[model samples]
Target: MEERRRYRRLPIKLELEINSLFKQNNDIIKLNNKTIEVIDISKNGIGIMCSDNFPVNYYFNAKIEFDEERYFYCVVKIIRSSKQGNKYCLGCEFVGLADFLADKVDEYEELLNKSQIY
Candidate 1:
């Protein structure tokens, strides 16, 4: 497959609760008691694994904790998904995420690079 992503993905696992999830039909869903694990992050999007399936183009809001003290409350749109074993692995893109927060992600990536971590 051709690499068309504008930014590189950084491996960063963060668990966050879904405040709300909106389906394409404008229905609201609450995925409680299930941990939505953000497995990877980039300036434009994130890769997440969860027990529940997120339909493509559906949106969800959550507060993603980048670190112990840093958090980003943002809306994400599920762009793609696949069933990985018993888990639903989905790729999501930030919707209207601020540039500063994206910069923060870049900074984290640079730090990981310096540390020789992928």
Candidate 2:
């Protein structure tokens, strides 16, 4: 028998900024700066490809904009990371997300569904 994953993934294509900080719950941290391309995004979290290495237990703030009109801020915790060619794959769990950002994620998922990209 083959194992099946429980969580459903939605396709996302967006550019995001990662700014790591030493303190938690604060958006003032700027440990390392990098630009990552989001591969997938959900209400709970996001996955992206980056070139830098972020140590575990690191907390950071992310700014993602789907379009010129839509943008959001999220506090993210690095859950898992791996290297794929020249880019590193990162799975981050969202923290302290506001209702507005959650709504935007839902909207993006719905758009992906209608476009048949899921």
Candidate 3:
């Protein structure tokens, strides 16, 4: 398969908590407090492996905590999903990624890459 992503996906493990999943009417359909593992991330989207088969095209808010005070939050829409053994791998795109948030993700990716180089 060919690579279609605009941004490079930085391979890193980050814990994210699903705050809420919304419906078309903006009503919350699901509330998840469990932490999911973010397999990879980029400026446009993130890949996560979780236990639930989240509905494709569904919108939700996720909170990612890099460290003590560094937290990134965004509204993401599920673009693709596939089963991986006992888990489900989901590809989600940021609905409206802010410039500051994009910068934060970029910085984190650079730092993560730097640490892996040693």
Per-prediction TM-score to the true structure, in the order listed: 0.87, 0.75, 0.85
**What lDDT score belongs to each candidate, Candidate 1 first?**
0.85, 0.74, 0.81
How do the residues 60-101 of candidate 2 rate in per-residue lDDT, one tens digit apiece? 777777777777877888888898998889888788888787
Flag regions of model 1 displaced more than 4 Å. 23-26
Listing every candidate in turn, what is its Cα RMSD in Å to the true structure after a full C-alpha superposition? 1.8, 3.3, 2.0
Position 29, candidate 2: lDDT: 51
Off by over 4 Å in 2: 1-7, 23-32
User: Ten-residue segment with the worst summed lDDT in candidate 3?
Assistant: 26-35
lDDT tens string, model 1, 38-80? 8999889999998878778889877777676666778899999
Alpha-carbon shift of residue 59 in model 1 (angstroms): 1.2
The lDDT, on a scale of 0 to 1, for candidate 2 is 0.74
Candidate 2 vs candidate 3: the TM-score winner is 3
Comparing 2 with 3 on lDDT, the higher-scoring candidate is 3
Candidate with top TM-score is 1
lDDT of 1: 0.85
Expressed as tens digits, the lDDT of each residue in 7-117 for candidate 3 is 998776787777667767766766558667898888898899999888887888877666766668788899999999999999999888888988887788767778884
Pairs with backbone N, CA or C atoms under 3 Å apart (clashes), candidate 3: none
